[model samples]
Target chain A: MTAAPAAVEARDLSKEFDGRTVVDRITFAVPRGTTFGLLGANGAGKTTTILMLLGLLRPDRGEAQVLGHDMERDRFRALQRANFSSPYVSLPHRLTARQNLTVYGRLYGVSEVRRRIEDIARELRIEDLLDRPVGKMSAGQKTRVGIGKVLLNDPEVLFLDEPTASLSPESAAWLRSFLGAYRDRTRATIVLASHNMPEVEAMCDSVAFLQQGRLLEQGAPRDLIRRHGKQTLEEVFLEVAEGDTGRQQGPGDLA
Target chain B: MKASLGRIGAMMTRYMYLYQVSPIRILELVYWPTFNMLIWGFMQEYLRSATHPAVFAASYLIAAVLLWDVLFRSQLGLTLGFVEEMWARNLGHLAVSPLRPLEFVGALIATSLIRTLVAVGGAGFLATLFFGFNALELGFGLALFFLNLVIMGWGVGLAVCAILLRYGLAAEALAWGALFVLQPLCGVFYPVSVLPDWLEPVARALPATHVFEGMRTVVQDGRLDIDLLAQAFLLNIPYALAGLAAFLGAYAVARRRGLLMGTGE
Candidate 1:
């Protein structure tokens, strides 16, 4: 059988702000229905790369594509089938979770929006919080509601930035399990950008490490750990972050 | 581009939800317009009592106050629509949604119309109740004057949004104060002829100047000056176009700078 087209792809995508290059010519692709993780330190351009892929930021060079549509030329088509969630981004604080979801559902053109919102609220275990204003909810609760916003349309491709940040251990674990189950059921492709290594290790089918806006390494978590001769992904991360100048390494070129 | 009415309606729904939930917000829409009407209405009475009673009709000043709000409230309505998203840090979410920028702007304009109607309606109602002056007495001139004023207000409102997007919240003060710069120049409370010889030309250049001038003609002469009305509509075409171009240009710059992802109060 023929392979399905990549759900998300970036070809030498670059972006610069005020003469400073924040995202260099980075390139990668995610196979259909798999989770791809973008791991980087703060100011490492992970967010910028994701923004370009989502067509939220214009690239200085190259292109990003989602669901076989060029993001720059035809992002609206891809966006209609995709959704994104980030902890840094927020829903309107004064609106209730249900209100926010209803708005989003309608924007996504989801039919029977009320029923969809109820289903999402139940699945996210936010049924009770749905009626409460977003500002009154705790951070963890807000995060789940944010995820519900992403799931409203049952996006074919999902972009998640730090999906589990600031959650308690139990809450984070629950969220991961829920996400994994959702992927299994829907086979939706997810691209995650996070500083949480273990979460990346547990969630991503393949991961890319970016240093100073450049792709430094990319592979399966186990393969990367074994190649670097480290016991865990965190140890390998510390070495990549501290032991080498970011410009020295190329993807899979470690001696 | 295929714009989605559903997306546009969704954005309008969010604003309505915010409007309905907050008592202070609902009260705020009518408060300032009503307050301005009462003060000016009372002051107009005092001027008639103290000065030449025949110099200006008693309804003239009250009508000016009511019409001026069409400009003020419409401008305020549009800017507040955008500023609310910034205050909530919801711009990033909006940026990624299927909702197009033009569609979002359309939603802002629709809400501004609602806000202008509510505020001006409240103030007009009070003028008739407290003072025996009804703004409706201006007849068809009132509708034409309102249309011209709203368009002029929207032109300024879009320019203010461009300023906010380019400079972030640090430039937020301009949103509330931008139209005030035009107040004196636009003859909101006086005729353009009352201005200094040097400033008269500058005042006449503004669309609101023509609008207010037309309003005075309707009230004082009880006839519409077709020239002023026509000038107001003609001036608005370019003014509104310039505002739209500035806003779209600023949006492109913000996208390049990646400001849409992080812009917030």
Candidate 2:
């Protein structure tokens, strides 16, 4: 039987700075065509791990493989098939949304780039603001533009760092539902790092619990909740977050 | 090999087009050459009183100021490019991309070459229109302008970029200051004869000084000196090579040190 492709697989990954272990020997594997949520409070090395996986950071020891490409040897080829998005890194402020997308699409050597730009812009619902400078857009508008820019090349592997980070509750819900639709259509492997536990419970097929750069547990969110005997994922998140998994609570608690 | 060359060609074309069309980049393109030539024009007027009687007055400073920019602004481009990446947070993305620092530097060099042409072209135009200094009329000086300027300018830029990459925002302002330091030492605005006797040896040691003096010699009197050209080749080859070496060394160090992460905050 042919083995299933691993979207991201890391072994003995480590990164240290000035004698401090930031991500200490962490390893995990994410299967393709599913969303893997990495959960931890801040400073848990969530971002660091993502950076290493994306080939943005190098590990001091061990092997990392992303999209079947050895992290060190063929990262560029791997990165060509992948794209990452984050709210923190702003797209070029001077360029209009359309201009920014075209520039990156060309850099990525995307075929039919003009068509791809218009299509991603339409999907992200920023067609109206396509000509507006990115700096002039609202936070929500900029977020959509950032998403559109990342989507312009139609990457096979997508990583979202706080995908719906700063949006209205209603808007975030619409965004989540839109992502659900996009996933159904593309089967794109999404590895999202987020603290929105409901988003995780609502969207993820599997969730990996991370604490202090260590994977504490991995299972379906629903199955983990059922096993923990919690009424809601939030209480489960609290229980896991507090290291108090035996507690009982209702779904209303997190809401 | 051919396919990779195609990819590099495509990237080079796309970015060169992007930077060329960018208003900010265009401004960077036009402003320095315009300003430096203006400054040189005024200085030439002042020094016209006591220049080489055999040669014309504008010859010394105009060519010197213009030559200095090739070195100074090219160095400045690398620093500003680093700053722009830091601002855009695109530096990390590029680093993570299959591009090595050399490829990244290659694109910047390409951009610098384009900018240098615009600057030199603009400077030459102004000198002709405003001061009647047609390099084509001078013959061969135009070719050396491209050769001496682009090559040595790129070397200076690489060195500056090396320092900027290793240090955080602290030395960025040095980009503007470098020309100020290099020019006086190179006698770009004045003849090396005007300096103290000891400084003549220092001026001879710098290739830029030779290029500037050679242009003055050629442009003013329609004469070329093989000795000055020889001196320029000898001095520039080592500095340019050393600067490029320093730049690559800094790139390796920055990659290891996480300065390339753009986390100066």
Candidate 3:
């Protein structure tokens, strides 16, 4: 019998803008129900890579597939079972969280949308903020609402670009725990892109460090630390950034 | 692929929710159309006494102004739906959803229909009250004129959205100014024959020109010009289809360029 397909796969994916390569021929596969991190500094092509996987951006070469559907041609099929969220993107400011949630729920074709919104609001601990306009909410509240939006459909594959990039530490920690619990409960495959090493180490099953639009290295956090003789993923990130030895490391073991 | 009406309705519902919160937004929709109607109505009254009264009927100017608002308001409504998504920075979220680009365009068109009716309906009611000129009296001619103008408006509105998608927020001024550039060419206030010899061909090529010319025939000749109405619709087939193609092309380019990821004002 054939092995089960990876929940997410990128085969030699690449992109460029204005003569500058943003994501060079990178390849990876994320197993079902696992949390994978794309750790990178700013301008390291983390967001661009996620966008291509979400089919919000087209790769200049190669393929991105989610749930065995080609992202470029069959994205709608994957999108039906997927959702994306980022603090950098926003909901309508004039709309209350409930209103915003209801709209997206309907867009995703959720049954009993009002009930789903209440359930998500309760899960995200956003019940009190439901009637408040998104613009009136603090950053933490908005991030919760954003997460609530993602969870509305109970997506099988979730793409999050810097999920807690702008939150305070306390809020970030709370969100990390919330997501960890969410993954445990739903068994959803999550692709998280962030530069925060601790967050990546805490939440990810495996991670790949990207530098200057290229994949520097990818492995289990602890294994990467052990392999590079480093104490933390942060130190490993620095070493990988300075060295050019990861061109051979691929997602072979993960796939 | 088959489009989902439920998704389209959901997008429309989002805009309707916006109106529910902002009374100012609702009021702005009707304010301009009504204001234009009243001003032109009073001017027609003045022209009745000052100029050759028999040269143009009393209802001619009032009807022209009312009909013209349908096109302007409809185009504004469609573009406003798009611009609102940009301002909210919600396009990125929308792009990743199960929503298709054409389905989103369908929502914009449907929302514009609702908006155009509210604005032009309110203004037309006022036209009947203030000028004692009932637009409804034009009968089937009114439907013909309304249909052709709205189609042309949607055609132009879609092209504007294409430009906005490709060029970013800097080109937003086209939303308001694009249709106005067509007004003088469409002969909203005068006959296309009154245009200079070199410009008449350009005027005649526009779908709105046939619509306004058709309106003038109803008002001045006291008869609906079926031939002109047919010509307007035939012209709209290409104009509207071209706009749809342009919008889809721009959406593809935006996807390739990753513009949809961060499009905002």
lDDT of 1 at A18: 80
* DockQ class, candidate 1: medium
lDDT of each: 0.90, 0.73, 0.91
Number of residue pairs clashing in candidate 3, backbone atoms closer than 3 angstroms, sequence gap of 3 or more or interchain:
0
Q: What are the per-residue Cα lDDT tens digits for candidate 3 across B1-265?
A: 3338989999999999998878789889998898899999999988888888887455788989988999998888999899999889899999899999989999999999999999999999998888898899899999989999999999999999999999989999999999989889999999999999999999999998998888888887889989999999999999999999999999999999999978997
Candidate 1, pairs of clashing residues: none
**What's the C-alpha lDDT at position B235 in model 2?**
73
Q: Write the per-residue lDDT of candidate 1 for residues B70-133, one digit (tens) a residue.
A: 9988988999999998899888888888888889888888899999999999999999999889
Give the C-alpha lDDT of model 2. 0.73
Error of 2 at B34 (Å): 3.1
Best by DockQ: 1
CAPRI category for model 3? medium
Give stretches of model 1 more than 4 Å off. Answer: A1-3, A241-243, A246-255, B1-3
Structural similarity to truth (TM-score) of each candidate: 0.96, 0.87, 0.96
Q: List the residue pairs that clash in candidate 2.
A: B75-B157
